[model samples]
Target: MVQAQDASEEAGTEASGGDEAAEDAQAMMTDESAIDDQAAREFFTSGSNLYSLGRYHDAALQFQQAYDLSERPALLYNIYLAHRDASEHAEAAVALRLYLEATPDADNHAALTVRLENLERGLAEQEASRVSAATAAEEAVRQEQAERERREAEERALAEDDKNIIPWIIAASGGAVMAVGVVTGIIALGLASSLDENCEPAVDGVRFCPSDPSLELENKQSALSTFAVMTDIFLIGGGVIAAVGLTWGLVRLGGAEDDEDAPTVSAMCGPTGCGASMRMGF
Candidate 1:
């Protein structure tokens, strides 16, 4: 009975020694992990100092190496700073968003808040300025189009006015020519009547020349002269009608032109050279 009790006690002591050895191993691993974390932190601080002094590339390398060993949120924030100093805005924004997500409560909360607000405000202002510029460009395009249309319309109106004037001028000239031709015909007819009367035979039934030709031609001459005068009067009346018709047609065509094209607004600048132009069209 005494030997059995002694063997059981020895077995219990061995189990306790084994348990202590396992605990000591775990403690050593914990200490090693803490030391590694401290080293990483020191490397990150050194990189941050370099970045502040404008050594961005070196800082990025250090932060990158530290991150490879341990993916800590604070180290990611340092990586963001290095990227920002190097003018890598896209990469910096990406890293910063990730870091903020990991640790929303960093040590420098007030400074972080101010920086975030400033970045947001700057981005918003830039967007607003871009929108305003776009709107201005659109307005300029619209104004140019309107001006082109107005100029085109003015040319059309001028062409139409010229068209109206040309027909009137042609008609008036044609009427004047017709009047001259009719007057000439009347003069020719009168001359022909005078010649025919002067050369007529005295005895009409026998068709023989009279002894006194002057007495024989007097009546025939008078009748031919009367016919010539009548022709001249009719030609004069036709000429007058043609002239009136031409004038009336031209006046009516002129009235039919667009009213909006009558008035124009124009702008000029400088002493000798002109600047921008502005015009209005109905």
Candidate 2:
């Protein structure tokens, strides 16, 4: 009988222990539920405050967090409202669609569907307008580049023409000098022939007898000597100048295009004589 009583007491103790464990588990669940509710309330309050401050995108994020914890269809509607006010049409449309799916029997289902369609259309137009603006900007850049290249080509051509003309000008100047020399030599020859016809030779070879007594033979002889000296001077100078000019011109024409310095030739005539000068630059 003592053993039987001891077993009954043991059974009572075990039953009491099981009851306490069940109560403890229930208390733990209640605490966790309270914590979740507090968190959800905080997120919801934050979302509402952000919305009032005109931070629609931030408000939408907070509302999404609250809905994640609570799984409330009403919170999804708040997210749609926030996204729509922020002009985030695509996000707003998605939120609205989710809300409608979650709450199929919502009172404004038809109106929300129509609003979603409008948002999608606006999104399409915005994308098309952006593509067109990009295309126009690219075309403007291409045209500007083409214009710049054309201007550069024209400038290069003008420079080349100027370079080519320099050689021709030098050569022409040399030809003109040679022609002047030839004319001067011809005048000297004419003066000599005239003297020969008007003066008679003497035995000493240094004296002359004038055919005309009043011809001023002394002055005529002095003029002839002057003309003879001038003719020799001009002919030698002119030939040297012409040769130099032609050679220089050929060199210039065949030289490298990048050479910046050019040689120059000049001619001068004075009462004493005529001569040519050349200058070169590094």
Candidate 3:
């Protein structure tokens, strides 16, 4: 700090003089130039040492610093050499182009041009390799997406089949029960009607049932009572089964398709026979 203050005082005294101050200023400028040259030399030596130690990128930076201090186009070519040794072909190409721009009339222009062409070719090959790798990655992603969609579609199809199976089974069971009930009921009615003339009402509508008290008549009446009770039981049971099946089917279908139409049921009863029917609107 003391030396810097003394130097400033000396510069102020020199400036106070006339020709002597101007001469001193010129000498200072000369000394600054020499210092810059010495600093540039130090940077250049450091860069050479680093390069010999196989630090090509560091060598390139050191050469760049030297070129900045000296403004020498030859140093730009040295930067290109360091970058080339580091396998940075694109950077080497850029440095060579800048060197050509800085020293347009250099004697080695043809040689630099050949080297630049080689570096540019290597850069182009690297770009093509990257593009090919990117395209392959994109194709792999597309195939993976397609496979995922296909699996999802298959799963959805299986789910739909599962949803429909319950309704199908219920409908088939209801149909079978209804058919069996109707056939058995008709046979029971026929057997009961066969005794209509023989069996008559006694007191308070109690049946005499075969019109006389003979053993054969009593047996016929018992058979008639049994068949009548069985007819009612089977028909009522079958009706309950069919109703349960239909209700369950409708409920399941409604859950499956909330936006779709529902099924309709119709029934008719007569003296000879009774039956029901169903229809789906959608």
Residue 61 lDDT (model 3): 91
lDDT of 2 by residue, 1-282 (tens): 000011111112233655988766766776776676667778888888899999999989988887887777878889999999998888998998898888889788898888878888898998899999999999999999999999999999898888767766756765776677678678767766666776665344344745556767676677766776677566756566666656556666676454444555676767656677676553
Sort every candidate by TM-score, greatest first. 3, 2, 1
Clashes of 1: 0
lDDT of 3 by residue, 1-282 (tens): 000011111223344546886878777887787777777767777788888899999988988887788777778888888998998888888989998998889888888788878778888998999999999999999999999999999999899778667555756676676566677667756655655566764454246663454666666556655655555544654565566556656666666464144455565655444555665544
Which wins on TM-score, candidate 1 or candidate 2?
2
Q: Is candidate 1 or candidate 2 better by lDDT?
A: 2
RMSD of each: 19.4, 12.6, 8.7
Question: Which pairs of residues collide in candidate 2?
Answer: none
> How many steric overlaps are in each model, in order?
0, 0, 0
The C-alpha lDDT values of all candidates are 0.59, 0.73, 0.70
Error of 2 at 160 (Å): 2.5
Model 1 RMSD in angstroms: 19.4
- TM for candidate 2 is 0.58
User: How many backbone overlaps does candidate 2 show?
Assistant: 0
Candidates ranked by lDDT: 2, 3, 1
The estimated TM-scores of all candidates read: 0.46, 0.58, 0.60
